[model samples]
Target: MSKKVIELDALEQINLDAAGIDIGAESIYVAVPPGRDTESVKEFPTFTADLQRTAEWLKKCKISTVAMESTGVLWVPIYEILEHHGFEVFLVNTYHLKNVQGRKTDVLDCQWIQQLHTYGLLKASFRPPEEIVEIRGYVRHRDTLVKYRSAHIQHMQKALNLMNLKLVNVLSDITGVTGMKIIRAIIDGERDPYVLANFRNKLCKKDEEEIAKSLEGYYRPEQVFVLKQSVEQYDFYEKQIQEVDQQLESLYKKYDPPDEDNYKNRKKHKPRKNQAHFDLGDSLYRMAGVDLTKIDGVDALIAQKVLSEIGTDMSKWPTVKHFTSWLKLCPNNKVTGGKVIQTGTQKTKNRATTALRIAAFSLSHNNKSALGSFYRRIKARNGPSEAITATAHKIAKIIYFMLRDKTDYYDLGENYYQEKFREILIKKLHKQAANFGYYLEPYNMAIPLVS
Candidate 1:
């Protein structure tokens, strides 16, 4: 028997001018096409001047495009510099680079990336427009501050507990109007429980007498000190969050203003807890060209968060399905031998998905909306987790179409949804009965039974 040799054709070079970069904290590895220079691969320091030199060398090699892994924040500077130099930058996800079989090193990684880019095998990750990116930065920072503030609020609660105070048990939130006033008075050296309770707001559910009893506690000096410091820290973060809200407001103003007539008849909704002090509904409406809050269970805060993550551009996704798949809200089924082996949504840290899920969960409190009815129906069939994912997926599709077409959301009401669902159930029953050689009929049409 003769041994046959196999020959494979090389992949077509789609991006001849492509280069690759492996970014590091203090250094960067760059790779260009062979023969572009004496050394096709080189290492450059990550300093600003050195990054500028790296760009110049790539330009000298006639490279017009670059591919790099979205490593931590280390890749950000290089990506920006390359983009500033007018080079087409592809911020490829690191997971996509893990499929190649080989010993992994910085030099080899850059070479592999370059090879992939030459063959047009890499897909760029989605990044919103620059303006949206700016808004995202501020929004993310605000979220961090909010988290910090929450920590201090817990600290205040711990101090109160140590002092044997039951203020939290009396008031819904210690940071609310009545709670804050009483807390400030306590910090200001007011030791009389009745005097502190005098600061109670009119809207407080508990009577002044009850509040006074809750305030009568063993206020140890050490615990009071902790409480004072925690209050100060919480106030500091609150100020910082307000500043971020101001920045967001400024950014929103840069977008085309919304038509006043559209909001003329809009119902006013009080801001939810920890929501921005500014008019987030109006700002988001102006920026997105659609009132996302009109969707059932989506409030101004949820809409703002989703918009900040995905921006106003729905063109990034080709269709609604693509949008939900990117969010990992839809099930990803894996099959083998024509049998599905796995089915579930991919785990993701996508903030937009989280916001949508929160919006979906909020529907449980609203039984009159169509989305609320749909959520309940799903929850009955599956568990709460599955229900939340399905509802979030549905909401995501609605948002995609709304943003893409710049249309308003109109709820058909829960009654309409229930009737439609009933019709669907009837159709399914009829089909099943026919398959079993039986027929489904109205009760009035059924044969009478003898006693």
Candidate 2:
């Protein structure tokens, strides 16, 4: 038997001017295409000056593009530096670099990344425009503060429990006006249940007498101290959140069109529960050039979140399919022998995707919007979870069209959509009858008068 020899095909280098870096906290490993320089692979210390020097070195080597893994927060500074230095930076997810088979090292990873990028095999992750990124940072920090406030609320509840106070049981929100007033009075040495009940808000569902009974507890000094601190911390976070909202509003004004009257005639969407305290609807409408909140199930907060993650530039995605794929709302099809073996959506940490899913879930209880009808139709066959994902995917497509066209969403009501679908079903039924050599006609039940 003759030994067989196999030839490996070489991939054409499409980006001859590309370079890649294996970034780290303490140092970075940089690589360029072969023969680019005497020292193709070099290590640079992780410092501002060193990063500048690295950029200078890449420029000297005639490198125009740079690729790097999304290595935690370490890649951010270098990415900005490279971007500032007029180099196109591709921040690739680490998962894409995993398919390169070899003994992996920092040096090898840079080489592999450079090789892959040269062949245009890697894709850069979607990052919103720079201005939106700044707003995103503030919004994300505000979310943390809000979560921290919730933790304090839980702490207050625990302290009340330890002191045998049933305030939470009587009040819907322990952080609301009534609960806070009673808690402040308790911490201020007002031990009488009747006096604490006197501070309850009139709108609270529980009667003042019943609230007085709930407030009666063996109040211990230690738990009371904890309760006081919790309330103070919650109050501090609330003030901080207020400041963040102000900052967001101010930042948002930068994009407000000089002619606010353009949106004055636009239909106003009802504010969502726990929506941002500021008037984000008008700003978002102006910025997006469309009112996304008009879409059923999409509230002001969710609209803001989706826009922040995706920006107002729908041009980044050429089509609705591409947009949904990037959002990880579409199915990832794996085929074997020309048959699909697995079909599932890519699991993502994208906040926009999460917000869309939540919005879709909310539509499960609604029967008015076309989207809600579609959700129920899907939910009938698949479970609620799959229905939510599918409905969110549809919403993603609607959003793509609305943003790309800069047009307001005009929903065809659920009744209209269902009627159209019913017509299509009737046509299909007629075709089936014809195939069986039978004619089909509309049936009406009416009796002729026998006068």
Best by TM-score: 1
Clashing pairs in 2: none
Off by over 4 Å in 2: 1-10, 258-262, 265-274, 447-451
Error in Å for residue 221 of model 1: 0.9
lDDT of 1 at 61: 99
Error of 1 at 98 (Å): 0.8
Q: How close is candidate 2 to the true structure, as a TM-score?
A: 0.92
lDDT of 1 by residue, 163-206 (tens): 88899999999999888888888888998999998988898899
Of candidate 2, the 10-residue stretch with the lowest lDDT total is 258-267
User: What local lDDT score does residue 374 receive in model 1, on the 0 to 100 scale?
Assistant: 94
Off by over 4 Å in 1: 1-10, 445-451
RMSD of 2: 4.2
The stretch of ten residues in a row with the least summed lDDT in candidate 1 is 263-272
Residue-pair clashes per prediction, in order, are 0, 0
Query: For residues 1-451, what per-residue lDDT tens digits would candidate 2 score against the true structure?
Result: 3757899888887999999899988999999987889989999999999999999999999999999999889999999999999999999988877766656775688988888899999899888889999888887888789899889989999999998999988998877788888888888899999999998887999998999999888989999999999999989998999898898888888875624565666666665435677888877776788888888888878888888889888999988999999999998999987799999998999999999999899899855989999899889989898999999999999899988987778789899889988999999999999999998977656855468
**Whole-model lDDT per candidate:** 0.90, 0.88
lDDT leader:
1
